[model samples]
Target: MDWLLNADTNGEKFLVMLAAVGLFVVVMGAVLVAVDRPRWVPQWLVVLGFIGPAVLMLVFGLVYPGLRTAYESFFDRNGENFIGFDNYVRVFTQDEFQIVLRNTAIWVLLVPVAATFIGLVYAVLVDRTRFEAAAKALIFLPMAISMVGASIIWKFIYEYKPDQPGVNQIGLANQVLVWLGLEPYQFVITAPWNTFFLIVVMIWIQAGFAMTVLSAAIKAIPDDIIEAARLDGVGGVRMFRYVTIPVIRPALVVVVTTIAITTLKVFDIVRTMTGGQFSTSVVANEFYTQAFTRFNFGLGASMAVLLFVLVIPIVVYNIRQMRLSEDIR
Candidate 1:
């Protein structure tokens, strides 16, 4: 086992990979044999053959890591000493980490709400437009870009230069402010507002996804219901409110929660744009900062655990909402 882990050479790494693949094949072959010889093997064994590997993988990959992280969260910086609850307490009580939590809350609250609203509105507006596909594509283009790429794009979009004589403002935002007879604003260096600005990039990236999902949901609204509403003089606002919205409310919930989770787990944009400085640090970014940058495994693990705790509720709520929506349907 020690030799297996000490594969420094390329040949050794290749052998390790080959061995892993061979092991997988062998396991599958054994399972298939058992499944084929069903009379000799119990029916449950066949079922287990199909599902047991996946369940075991989950236990090893997801469940075990999660449990181990939780356990490590209770230990000290090096994972050698016991320091129960202190790391968690520091995460909440420390001003900097508190800022991280606050920023995370802001990201979770604002990004999903703004993105969903923009997407819903855009989806509705372009539902049956002459250039519907083009319009949707324009909105959705950002989602195609990698988060790092998108961040770089927006970094230029929000670029700022000192308001000095003969100095050209390269950032679109500052140029807009300059056009309006105002000084160039340092978007990333400012607190609170900088966080909001970083959030706008995420919203820009996510709105298209929301639009795509909500658009399908909107289109799926029964024509009879829409026609009935129109016959009763319920057009425009009334029709959309009573017919379009309620019918797609489940989808809207799904979009919001999906974006919320995505926003919660966001790290690249903050890292790229501001490097999590200027009070714009979120839990995900801070987790990286702690675990890798600071090398405080205990604190990092605690942050990881906190993130897990925070995500669990949102996920549970999403699942419950999905179930309720299905039940309603």
Candidate 2:
């Protein structure tokens, strides 16, 4: 026991030694079963032999690591001196943390609804048209790009240069403003509005997914219902409003909830484009900044736990909606 507690091991070496001994015992038992004339050994023993490796791997890999992270969230960065909910309090009270929470709420509210609405509208408008596939393919193209890649592309679009002699603006948005005889604006650096600009990247990527889902839901509507509606003189905007929207409500809910979940965990675009600067940080990016950049592991973990708490209800609701939709169908 004294040897196991010695500074040379730091306790981890003892765990390793214990594991090695257990593994050796298991292996030797298996070998003896194979080599010796052991008629009494049952088939369940062989099944246990196969299951042991997998069980050990799972305990060592997932279970151990998750427990360790949760444990570390209670301690300081160096894993010393327990300081309970102080990290959580810091997250709520600090100005920077408040900004993060506000930005996250804005993102949660804006991106999903806007993206889903745009996608649904686009899908319905193009549903029976000649250019439907082409339109959808074009819109869906952005989803294929990695988040970092998309951020870089949008960064170029939002590029800003101070008004100078003979410097042509490379940013498309500023170029458009210049064409309209307006002064060029620095999109990324602008506070309050820059967050929305960052959000555009997410919306651009997610809108296509929403469109595809809603389009499928629309197509799944029975042709007999459409014919009956037409027979009753229901057509145009009235028919769509009275009929199409009601039928596709399930899909709309799914799309909005899925987008909300995605928005809650959004980190890459903010990290790549803004580096969590200029009041553009959200919870996910703030967690990274706290955990890795500032070495405030406890605060970072609390942020992570907060994020998980926020997301769980959304996911559970989405699951219930899906099940209800399935039952209705």
Q: Compare the candidates by lDDT and give the number of the best one.
A: 1
Candidate 1 structure, TM-score to reference: 0.89
Q: What is the TM-score of each candidate against the true structure?
A: 0.89, 0.82
Please, what is the whole-model Cα lDDT of each candidate in the order they appear? 0.92, 0.89
Q: Can you tell me which runs of candidate 1 are displaced by over 4 Å?
A: 1-45
Candidate 1 residue pairs in clash (backbone atoms < 3 Å): none
Model number with the top TM-score: 1
Write candidate 1's Cα lDDT for 187-289 as tens digits. Answer: 8888879999999899999999999999999989989998898899999988889889999998999999899988888999999998888999999999999
lDDT of 2 by residue, 113-142 (tens): 999999988998999899999999999999
